[model samples]
Target: MSSTEDTTAQSSIFKDCLARRVIAQPALSDTPDASSSSSSGSDLDEFISYLASEVWETLPSQLRALTHEHPVIDVDADALSLATIPGSFTDTLVSYGIAADPDSACDFLRSVLRDYVDEARAPPPAWSSTRTSECEICERDVPLTYHHLIPRSTHTKVLKRKWHPESLLNSVAWLCRPCHSAVHGIATNEELAREYYTIELLLTREDIQKWKKYASKQRWGVRRG
Candidate 1:
């Protein structure tokens, strides 16, 4: 098949996979016996095979080269941006309404190829020794911790009660240790999940701002009270 035909087939299968997951049905993994005479099943398997082999060649060469070296698709911010920006295979797909945007594309691809991708496309907002990054809150050049916007502790209850969408469960903020402590100190997990999920929303509080200002000045390794 041609590249466009291959991409269109892949996108359709991917969308079907996503829809099946949403409604709690088996998607791509279902197989049909040769005697079953299920054309749709046979076609799906063909597209899946194409995905395993030829899909990489359909992508932008830079992205293809990048993923070729890594066992898992590491979709950092820049890579995610390329999905919506001009001149990318994902952009073309988005233009055709195959997915909403980068986030949606990531979700669709992740769901469709669950084993090949990480659980989450974005890295957890924590910092480490060799790859330390600045805190999202205090902007401190310190070790950071991953603060789940909707605390994992509350996920079951939240979903059970239909309090929030499943997508928000994995949303996160990268904070320095003290700032991280101050956030949980000021609000309950439920409150954080509902009202203070975003950094912009969290920064609106005087207490959090005060904490940021104070914590930003402190050197690394200073613990919060």
Candidate 2:
């Protein structure tokens, strides 16, 4: 077999073996190891980081199934894997306000998750269409637009997950002109689909907040990230 084929075969075997091992083993949760809990602070941090990465990695599949949009995106990726979609990823990243470089995309996605936890503790104000509302992130009273937690571009991924897609379409937040522009400026459609799509998640990014604050105060112009 070719090298690529050989690698695929090996991966399949590895997964199968892992499945068999899991099937034969007792649940670790039921027999927790004391040493596991007693791990060093650095070790704990590493594990938590790994866990978050894994969650983002697998989120697209979940989104496809849950959102129930049609033509479900069959490609595999998470926020960290945005570089995989090179041409489109780079284009969208630049349009969204972030630098269109592999290093920049990877670095941004890696650190964005921690912001979500902070958002949970102190949520931003929800966007309203009927009444004037400040930008949720910058607190600027600029005109706001509906920002999808899952970009409309990702409706296909949603179709993959859900039996119905209406709920996903209905879910969105409001962002002021500059903040909204900034969001699209910093992240790609795939990245938004997989992570950093929610209002709370967005609020936690101090870097984005800095952008918003600067934009809100600047009369001349709002710069993209």
Candidate 3:
């Protein structure tokens, strides 16, 4: 064959190979498997429903009112905003028994809101005000501020934005001032984010109670009483 013809043939073969490779690569916008997505979502819904019946069934009667009034879907927005924030909130929600099903997630949130409203109606507990409280860390006897165990800034952007305020509240814990500051500092330092994340992930009511006991012991410099 002529050199010119040979070169053209080689170029055509190279183009064909490149086209095949491109086609074999995954499509960025390929439609998700609707059946699989729906099934997974359904399972999540069942889980959330079970959680609601188990964990929230005994919540105060007043708290139930909050859930009954709130709608499941956001009225102003056309779509949920789950894509913009950290996955921890979502993961925690699921971990705490929020179902993957939209309806189940909504019901769980409704119950949570009811609890918040009930809490709001009652007189603030003695420990609610920070001014008279002691720090959980640093052994300082100083005024306290409510520290959201899961940072409010992060939570609002993630769970509340996607779900409701009540759901966020049920998922959080109150921290004394020093511990709050230390945790925030830890969270801010990139080197410590993982540790802070783990702390938040592992936190439970028992852990909070234990921390409070430790703080109380430190404050008095003695065991109970």
Candidate 2 ranges with C-alpha deviation above 4 Å: 1-131, 161-166, 219-225
TM-scores across all candidates? 0.41, 0.37, 0.23
* Candidate 1 whole-model C-alpha lDDT, 0 to 1: 0.51
**Candidates sorted on TM-score, descending:** 1, 2, 3
Worst 10 residues of 3 by lDDT: 216-225
lDDT of 1 by residue, 9-104 (tens): 334333333333322222222322212333323443443334334344443443332222244554352243334433454453355455667666
Residue 106 in model 1: lDDT: 59
Error of 1 at 171 (Å): 1.1
The lowest-lDDT stretch of 10 consecutive residues in candidate 2 is: 15-24
RMSD of every candidate to native, in Å, equals: 18.5, 19.6, 25.8
Q: Which one wins by TM-score: 1 or 2?
A: 1
- Global lDDT for candidate 3? 0.35
What digit string (tens of lDDT, one per residue) describes model 3 on residues 35-57?
Answer: 24223333333333333344233
Q: Pick the winner on TM-score between candidates 2 and 3.
A: 2
Better of 2 and 3 by lDDT: 2
Off by over 4 Å in 1: 1-127, 221-225
lDDT of 1 at 115: 21
With a 3 Å backbone cut-off (N, CA, C), the pairs that clash in candidate 1 are: none
Q: By TM-score, who's the top model here?
A: 1
Q: Which pairs, if any, clash in model 3?
A: 44-100, 45-101, 63-114, 130-144
